[model samples]
Target: MGQQYLFWFAQVHDDFRIPELQSVAEIHGFDLHIPQDLDASRPFCILELDHEEHARLLARRCILIRSVCEFYARGSTYEELHERVRQQRPRWSCYIEDTSFKFIVTAYNHTIPQARQREVVESFSYMDFLGKIDMKSPEIIMTCFEEYPDKHGTTRPKDEGDGEFKEVFFGRLIEEGSARPLVKKFDVKKRLYYGNTSMEAEISLLMANQTLAAPGKLIYDPFIGTGSMAYTTAHFGALVFGSDIDGRQMRGKDKQPGIIRAASQYGVAHCIIDLCTFDVTRNPWRCGELFDAIITDPPYGVRAGAKRLGRKSRQDKEQPPTSPQNIAFRRPDDQPYIPPTKPYELSSLASDLVLLARYMLKPQGRLVFFLPTVTDEYEELDVQSMLCDGMEIVANSLQNFGSWGRRLITIRKATTEHFAPPSFEQLDNVAHIPAHKDFREKYFQGFKKSDVEQISELSDQG
Candidate 1:
């Protein structure tokens, strides 16, 4: 008279949840019957059957199912009432049929005492209990008392000494280890151009794990400030290559030796390049050379004074100063060069991204980049437009760290064999744009002209 039950775990993202469940199923070597329109909100379900062990096996694989409860009840205390009920019962009590009654016990109450809870749990027989209970409108109740230390200095409860009563009322359900599967670890540090932290490295590892980059595949990072992105990718078995405009900033005299050292420490192969320049407008990398994936955190509107060229004063501007304004800021060892324009524009930041996408990425390769969304339009709209034609946005997620609005955009190159551009025109008729007033009213709070000017100036330097 044992019973069977079906259990399921609630998951956050439906996209990966099925895969996780399938992985669990494979481990247990069982075929789970999933309803086509199953309700995720209702976490667990039970089925009455002869084989209870098979039900337990299914429960173990469903790690997402947090807790489970079974239905059972003992006989009434009144002997005369029981005898009257027995006289009305059917003759075949010992060999009950499966469809005898459909007792729906939806509610339960805990009634077991703490001291005798364990002993009570060991004595109850699931099979025997199922046989005795009336199937219709059964009361599902269990007695269990849990101990909690008095936080407000309250007195403890006096002993009642009812061990046998406790054993008859409640029992403990044992859980099988079916849920937590082993996850592969990527051991490396990640330093975002925006900032450096252990959390950023962990996030990068999570993103990399989602991609199909295999071991020995080249993972390139063009804007490898301190090699955080490169480090995380390499730790997962991909060969990493990182480059920075100023290699000195990567290691200097004391810090870790950039991506090269990071890869070595993590037991991954890597190469580092210094002062490499590639214009995004035109693909600069040699043809035929490509990477399996590219991940980077482009430099935001922040600059080091020593690393930046300064502007000439207004007083000296009319005369066209004999020496360039940035001459004073250049390193002592470096020779001063005259500025072609009054204030030499820093290298275009957006162009670097375009170059990386066009020249470096392989066909069907994936890219995960973090960009700050401070302005209404990103500076590299042209590059984005170009990418839109050949790439699909897989995920656009936001990560807010302090004042920065970091947007993580994951994109994958269109599979050329069966690729077709999305028909935006067809959807435009139904597309809704939030009113301009709504945006201005919500985001313009406490915003001043000076703040915009300051942000504009920062974007120029980088």
Candidate 2:
């Protein structure tokens, strides 16, 4: 008689390419077998009876047994075992004499048909059989074949049906039963400003397209406002680190609690570090650590606090005091109110992005971030310049969430040997300049008339 065994695969993200279950089995010296014609995509596998001894060997080595057949030793034929039991007792009939032997026999036969083949030396009794057997002490119990159904929908019988059984591996069962449920109770999407419930599913698909970092590679996010980008990336098994200049935005009364909740829900390990409070116009990122990849969404002007309606006044003559012109503005009612800092000029945003690419990214590493179109005319030009500065644009696509139209840009840092040549469009041109002259003149004093003339001359020469 051969032993029987069961195999199963653990759930994982699509980006995790290794077949974890099969590898584990092979390591333990079990003959790996898939059900005949089983789809490779299916989540389970069935090793047949041919490798029974090998299965038992692995099971013992791997501590796979949930229960054991203590009363019935392995490799014992049914009739021979019964005869041996009869020889041990001289007056076994006395035990069955008072019990309903017929009923016991019927139930026992229904469960294990091998019982019927052996004649009872004394009259068979249900109470006697029940008293002799201990269900809880079994190291491995034999199950009827009626339970397992194949893909063709045919089920094997208890007796004549190969007695095919599935062993419930003790450790694996306990681990699965004790594991936390994947879906969280809260409406995760509702917690986000423009998030949808399908965002997780969509991100899972995008991560599948990229090569996953091995378990310890660091994934960084600079503009991690609510931690969504970090949360999604960490699901693929990378260690995530994130920072934001405005810690208040990440830790606001309403927003901070949500970040905590999301981190709890997703099982992402992270640390919130400050990216420094210097203004983007005056300072570049000073974070010393480099990352394998960076993915984030910077603030877009749509629905910004500066665009909110001001307080209504009873007297028409009451001009709202506008003396503090440089003060950042915010809507008090909104969670994590951001003071209105000077708006980002498109050229400055592009320049800051280029700087981030140079400093933060590892050679040949990737970056995926969202860039919104501030103005229609500059959309294509901004994208082109970013790509021309030694970054390879792998994917550029539209992301529509609520009323905002966002462009998702995926760029890979180029190695020195394969550095992308700077393009004509990337040169200082009028289209790359700020739209307001006064703001430009005050903030961009470093930019020279000669530089502007040089750009114009280059444009004409092109």
Which candidate tops lDDT?
Answer: 1
CA shift of 22, model 1, Å = 13
The runs of at least 3 residues in candidate 1 whose Cα sits more than 4 Å from the true structure, single-residue gaps closed, are 1-199, 254-256, 269-284, 302-355, 374-387, 400-404, 415-462
The C-alpha lDDT values of all candidates are 0.42, 0.42
Worst 10 residues of 1 by lDDT: 163-172
Best by TM-score: 1
The segments of candidate 2 whose C-alpha lies over 4 angstroms from its true place after superposition are: 1-187, 190-214, 254-258, 270-289, 305-340, 374-382, 400-404, 417-462
As for model 1, its CA RMSD to the true structure in angstroms is 13.4
Tens digits of lDDT, candidate 1, 1-462: 554333333332223333334333433455545456754433333335345554455445343443333322222222332343345334223424332222221111123355444443433322233433544543332322222222235443544323222112111232333432311133332221223432254445434543443466777776566666665565546776665544554554545554455555555534332224332222245453367777776654333211222235574667654554456666375654433222211123323353345445677677777654434432434225325355666555555433334555567766543332221111223222211112222233323456767767887998
Q: Model 2, 1-462: lDDT tens per residue?
A: 333333333223311212222322443445455445754332233444444445444333221122112121111233443454455343244434332221111121124354442332132222144333434543222221122223234454545433332211111111121111222322345344323212343433243223233356577665566666555456546766656555554554674445555655666545322233333333354552367777665554333311112333443247543544423353344554443343454444554665565556777677766665423223455676655466677556554442334565667778653322222132445455432222233223323456667766888999
User: What's each prediction's clash count?
Assistant: 11, 9
Span of 10 residues, lowest total lDDT, candidate 2: 170-179
TM-score, one value per model: 0.45, 0.40
